[model samples]
Target chain A: MSTPIFANFHPDFYVERLWDKCIKCKRCIRECTYGVHIWDEKKKTLKEDHTKCVGCHRCSAMCPTNALIIRRHPSDFREHALWTPWFIKNIYKQADQGGVLLTSTGCALPYKNYFDHLVIDACQVTNPPIDPLREPMELRTFIGPKPEAVEVEEVNGRFRLKKKLPPVIRIEVPIMFAGMSYGAISLHVHQGLARAARDLGTLYNTGEGGLHASLYEYGANTIVQCASGRFGLHIDYLNAGVAIEIKIGQGAKPGIGGHLPGEKVTEEISKTRMIPVGSDALSPAPHHDIYSIEDLRGLIFALKEATEYKKLVFVKIAAVHNVAAIASGIVRAGADAVVIDGLKGGTGASPTMFRDNIGIPIELAISAVDKRLREEGIRHRTSIIASGGIRCSADVVKAIALGADAVYIGTAALIACGCTMCQRCHTGKCPWGIATNNPELMKRLPPEVAYEKIYNLVKGWAHEIKEMLGAMGINSIESLKGNRDKLRAVGLTREEMEILEVKHAGE
Target chain B: MPLELEVTPFHYSQVNKIIREHISKGEREFVLRGVNGHRYLFAGVSAEVSAVIYGTPGLDLGAFMRGPVIRVFGSVQDGAGNTMDHGKIIVHGMAGDVIGYAMRGGKIHIFGDVGYRVGIHMKAYMDKVPVIIIGGKAGDFLGEYMAGGIIILLGMNTIYPERPIAGLFLGTGMHGGAIYIRGKVRENQLGLGLKPYALDSDDEKLLESYLKEYCDDFGLDISEILKEDFIKIIPYTHRPYGKLYAY
Candidate 1:
């Protein structure tokens, strides 16, 4: 045999099999597509090849008996806290191929989660907690630009309202399903998210992959994205939505574009994206025509003109260092809403360096943008939607209490659909069928089941949000929006508290 | 019969409202006079109406328009026919920058010169081919990142014939479109991933077909415009960054 092109410096996972319980049933050999388990016919036994395992636990879950276990491989090199195994392995990977390291999912570094640092306040004697079961606790939210001042006119001696307000999307809950493109995930996932959005009276974003023809029925709950690729953009696509989102940058891979490999551009994906079957779909880093804020205004108005001003338009940007200024520019550009994606956001695929080493956390970005817009006296001109790293209902509550009109959950929604966060989304062989385009793998997730699970997850979170609001003695979610006074920080520096516009605990 | 609506005070939103209201009430033809810088006129109006404008209209004229015919007697501001899906915009005078930006379908015919970044990100799908025909010279970065469609720049009434038909960095990042210029193009002016090819029979036929309509509308001689040799610029590959990644 010829020598291998690249060296396998180390195995990331280790497989342990119980000899007494295995019984040589060969279940793992059949279930594993990574070839981690092999059948030794000469010895009439099964052998474990730990080198090929990605620790997805596909075979372990499928095993009839409790005989297989997979764990992170122990480090064998000389131990140094600074030179961790991951760092050394990454160096070896780059040294071998001289290529940029690629990874998927959110940042892996163990950064401090600000959501954990902030605490929510409850009512005491001055205000009484309303029982949600007996009293009506409103969770309904409308997302769009609010009128700074209502205009009135006298018609035939009767005063009539003359304010021409922008379109607003009403959701039963303050939680929304974030933008996840069709090519990055399977059709079943999109269908599930669409159905959930429709049933829950919310919106689901079609992230730059273009809306599938079959999903046109869900247009009432869909928000189509117009990214740099300009893929699959036509009159029908523009008309088939309640709103349009101009994707300036994604939080996970800020300042970088996306490259859907040619191998993943199957016939169905090619039709949706409007490219050739075997050609790579490359979304350039920046829109060639948009060199300034004026160009951005032109694009935003172009979409508005195309849709006849019937749908709201949003501009989604990554939360960079100057996100406050960027948000101000977007609002002044006449966008109906603004979406800020934090550094901890997830992606289908991103470079390893970009995912882990760029962007600020969502908490700081949201507070700063909110304060800046309020200071500029244009806070009511546009709505702000925070995304990235939202895990539970508490995070949502904290986000709204800090200043977000709504929160977008991508990874949380995926987890409800049976995702394990393996971070192998770029590999196209997802064991859980959450991020793969392979038909066989995709079939593992049924839309009906996924939809029910997602609906239940968001419904549960909505109930929790209502409960939190009730505890604060707030009857409506509108009162909780940008109410930073209801929150306090713990174990945070004075500068952090000042930036977040919150007070210290027990002060 | 065509209806008439005069817009004197120049409000962009009011003009569009009137156009939409008229179109909704089965008014298919309209004559809009005193159109001084009213942006987004006839935007996203889907009716097959015929509109005639007198004065200069503002930015984003006929944007996202579908199945309408708008003819401007005077020049227009920037971003005319921006992201238009299906329709026709005929301008009698010069146009501004970023003309036809991200337009997917329809036809825009400009009689005079246009500013920078014309035909940027103009794309085409199956059976829907967007076409832009400019009679005079064009500025820099023409057809930048153009995925699909056809752009023809005819140097008919160009003031400076010694200069190139288009400015520098023409066809930058163009992937799936063909741009035909009436005059010579230097190698230094061409952007990366762009190459000039000799006109084939198909290209000549396309140019003749588009120029015929343009000349007919502008009262120009098609035969005289087509007499000069043309150079075709096309992207080197549909997948420009295919080999940039490692498996």
Candidate 2:
């Protein structure tokens, strides 16, 4: 085989073998698909090729004696905080390939997690905490435009409610699966998410890859996306979902379009995406017809017309600097809801520079949008869904308190299904089979197994959210939404606290 | 054929309700008059019905419609026949932008001009063909990102014969589908990934059949329209950005 013009710059992981414990079992050699471990026939011992290791830890987990250890390669650069080892290595990578370096998953840079700094208030005096075990804590959330006021009438000595409201989707929990296409992940993963969404009474997004025929049975729990590519978009696809989301942008790569390489467009993917086999699926940066807010309104109404106004329509945008203004325009454009994808959002593949350096974090975006809509007296016009890096139930609670109706979890969902976050999803060779399309690798993940794990993960988070709400002296999740008085920010500037509409700690 | 509904004061929802109620009662043929800009008329109605609309219909007139024939006597608004699987929409007057947006299977015959991005992202599946025939000129970005289906532009009354029939960047990012223009097209007006070709016998046959229906709908002479020389624009390669990546 011919060598590449550019060599592998440096080892990303170090494989440490316990010499006394290894029994030459060769399990690591068999488990690693990247060829990181090889059995040396001449010496009758295992050898490590550290250069190929993606730090997925597949071999280490498979080792019977726990003889294999994987660690991040030690920083070898001179101690300079500004020009760190990661910075220098990325420079080398760009210099070698002269191409945009692609990475997967969320941002790995050290940014403050606002959720950790914000503390939820618990009742001590004046009010008492309700035990969730014995009390009924309503976690059900209705996502759509709420009515402005209730209208009642008395007809023939009988009082009746007479308010017509927009269509709303009710979910048992306020947590939902974010948009991730089938070609980006495996069919089994999509099935797992679909099953989990059905069991949890939530919705899972199809993420612009068109709905598969087999998954049509879960239409009540599906949110089909109509992206710029218009892939696999037909009348049936539009009518097969509970809601339709117009994907304007994603947080990881805000201003650019998505390029699914022709190589990844296998036969099944081609059918799902409605493109020719081996043809690249290029979603343009902007919808060709939607140039202004009026254009967006036209498309929104068009979709509503297509589905006969039976399904809620959502407009999803990245959390950019002007997210508040953009969100307001989306509401005015007749969307039933708006989703803001923050900078820490995960992706199947994105340029490393764009993923790490584009868009604002979800915390600030949600707060600003919420404040803007409230100031305009249009907060009840539509629902807001905050998505990015919501790690735990606390993050979801914090988001709701900051004015979000719900939260979408992408990377966390993948991690629940055995993903190690190796950030090699773009390679199409994921070892755990969650992000790859290779038939052999995809076979490793069974839909039933993934379904159970994800179901338990969301179920646990829902219980925790209920516990937090009960401790706050709130019986329903709605009472906690937009109730910023229940939260206090620590280590945040006065301006930051003002923007978040929360008080500083000990105020 | 005896049912008649006046949609003047009723909201779009009420209009649709009345139409659906009539449809559910096995009334396939109806006359809808006094339609004053009501949107979503006959949307997602998958029945073999014929609706004759008199006044101007609003946006998305026959969206997601299947197996129905909607004949509008007046003009229509934007997004007409949006994402329709199988249907026939005949518009007598001018239509707005994004006409036939992402329509997979059906036929749309427009008698007058249309706005920008007409037939954007239209595609076809196995044995399902979608066709759009425009009698007059079209705006910019015509057939943009067109994956499959066929679009024909017949410049019957050319305001400027010196200029090209369609606007700039025609067929931008078009991978599949064929565009037939019945006038002169300059090389500079064409977008990337496209190459102009002469009409083959099969192309002539397809154009003849579709134009025969179009002529029948609009009361035009098919022989006079076919007398003009036509040029066919198709994508040079199915994969436009196949070599844009390193790996």
Candidate 3:
């Protein structure tokens, strides 16, 4: 017999079946999309193959009785500090297949998560904290370019604005749905996101994939993206949303591109992307026409002109080194908003190497960009949206205090929609149905059911944001913007604090 | 009747504002003279309007415009027909880079040579098949990453005879589209796994129809332009990167 791979022989997860509690119902067999469970016909019982388990826990959750426990395999190779098990296993897999390692979602490496090391400040004796229930707090945020100065004129014994400003988008909450492409995820999830955004008075992004014809009614709450591929880009799609975003780079895989495989291009996806059925949809590493900052301005104006200057235009870039300079350039290029996605962003599919090791954290990026733009006196020209790795409402408050105008939450939204982050989304076998396009899996997540869940999550977060604001003795969210005095680093180094533009605790 | 103007004194933005204001006022015809380096002219004008421009126009001449016909007598800068939905832009002189980038529905007929990266990622939907017929040579990366639409490169009647009919990386990463070269292309000039083939009847019909329009616009003989043996290039497989990943 051929030698089995070590990872398969000693799997990452071990499924323990409590034979004492099992009733021979074989529910696990029906729920296992990875085909890990089976019915032993001779024994008339249920069995499992540990090697096939991705640790999604769908069967365990749906099991009638508490009969299963999925745990990490307590096995290890010879200990080596530098050469870890993951590197060894990945090298073995690459040697066997001789192809690029593909992965789903964000970086799983144990890099420093700055959000965990920072703390928010609260009111003390000098200022009393207000009660959120008894008092009204303003969480209303506007996203667009602000003029250099406000000018007023007297008309009919009434003072009115002298000049008209550009279009602005108002959101009741400071949180938004990150750009999730339609082909990478199911349509039900998109419908849920769109409806929830409408319900919450916020916006949801349509990532590069063209908007579906049925979702035209929700254009007022949508921000359609123009990716490098220019997929489904027409005059109608350009004007189909409240604003337009030009996707320059994604955080999970910076400097790389995106490709939706031909096999996954169903008829519906083909029509939305405006490509032929079964054709590979490729977004190259760069827009061939965009080679400089001026070129970036060209495309921004193209979308603005395409939409007849009625909608705000945003530019999304990965948070890499010198991000502050890049943000300033984008602001000067006529961008109304700059979305900086950090390295911890999620994706449906990306090369493993790029996903794990590219771009800086969003915290440092927000501080750097905000400081640079303010120094350049162009901070009012654009709004800064910090994305990637934002977890709870606390993270949103901290991000705003660190200098972001708002935050985009992707994984948090997915978790609310029943995603367990199995890390197997690219395999097209997502049991919870959040990432797959297969009809059988797609039916598992109904849009009507998922929209309510998303709505609850955002509404709950908005309330929590108000509470946090009240604790800080501030009743409005705008007061929290760039107010680093409310934040103090707990365990970060001096250099790190300097980069984040925050003071150390007990200083 | 055309609303005539001398657009030399105003900036490109001001000229565009004037054009937009006129377009919204039901003025469907315009004749602008001395339009030196004026960019974004007639942009996003979806009306069935027409413009006759004299002197050189800057970048993105008719970008995102629909239902408007523009005739330019001088050479244009970069990004002439950028993402244009529906219109006709007839350039009587040479053009710059990225002329037909992402154009969905329109006909761009350039009477002279074009710069690099022309027709990149130009796609089509239903009856909105975009067509670009180049009367002279093309620079590098022509038709690179094209998903759909038709590009015809006629490398003749140009000042740069030393240049190749089309440059390197022609149709690189192309899928779901056809590129027709007037004569022939070496195997090295083609994208990976893409091959040139003899024209079928349907291809000949497409060429005849599109070339007649080109010939009529330039006042050239259709027979002379079609005298050479043309070749068509289409990808061998729509899924070029299917086997590139392990999972």
Scored by lDDT, the top model is 3
lDDT, candidate 2, at B36: 82
Q: Which sections of candidate 1 miss by over 4 Å? A: A1-7, A15-53, A63-68, A95-98, A123-128, A149-167, A257-259, A288-295, B160-162
lDDT of 1: 0.85
What is the per-residue lDDT of model 1 for residues A291-321, given as tens digits with 9 covering 90 to 100? 6788788778777876777888999999999
> Which regions of candidate 2 fall more than 4 Å away from where they truly are?
A1-4, A14-52, A63-68, A74-98, A154-158, A164-166, B159-162, B199-209, B219-229
- Please write out the lDDT profile of model 2 over residues A1-507, one tens digit for every residue: 964533364777889999899998898887888999988999888898887899998888879999999998773657897997777767766666666777888877768778888999999988999889999999999999988887999999999888666679999999999999888888889999999999999999999888788899999999999888777777788888899999999988898777666656788887777667777777878886588998899789778866778889999999999999999999999999999999999998787878899999899999999999999988898999999999999999999999999999999999999889898887777788888677888888988988998999999999999999999999999999999999999999888888889999999
- How far off is residue A17 in model 3, in Å? 4.4
Model 3 C-alpha lDDT per residue in residues B126-145, reported as the tens digit of each score: 77789999999998888888
Docking class of 3: medium
- Model 3 vs. true fold: TM: 0.94
Candidate ordering by TM-score (highest first): 3, 2, 1
TM-score of 2: 0.91
Native contacts retained by candidate 2? 0.41
Better of 1 and 2 by TM-score: 2
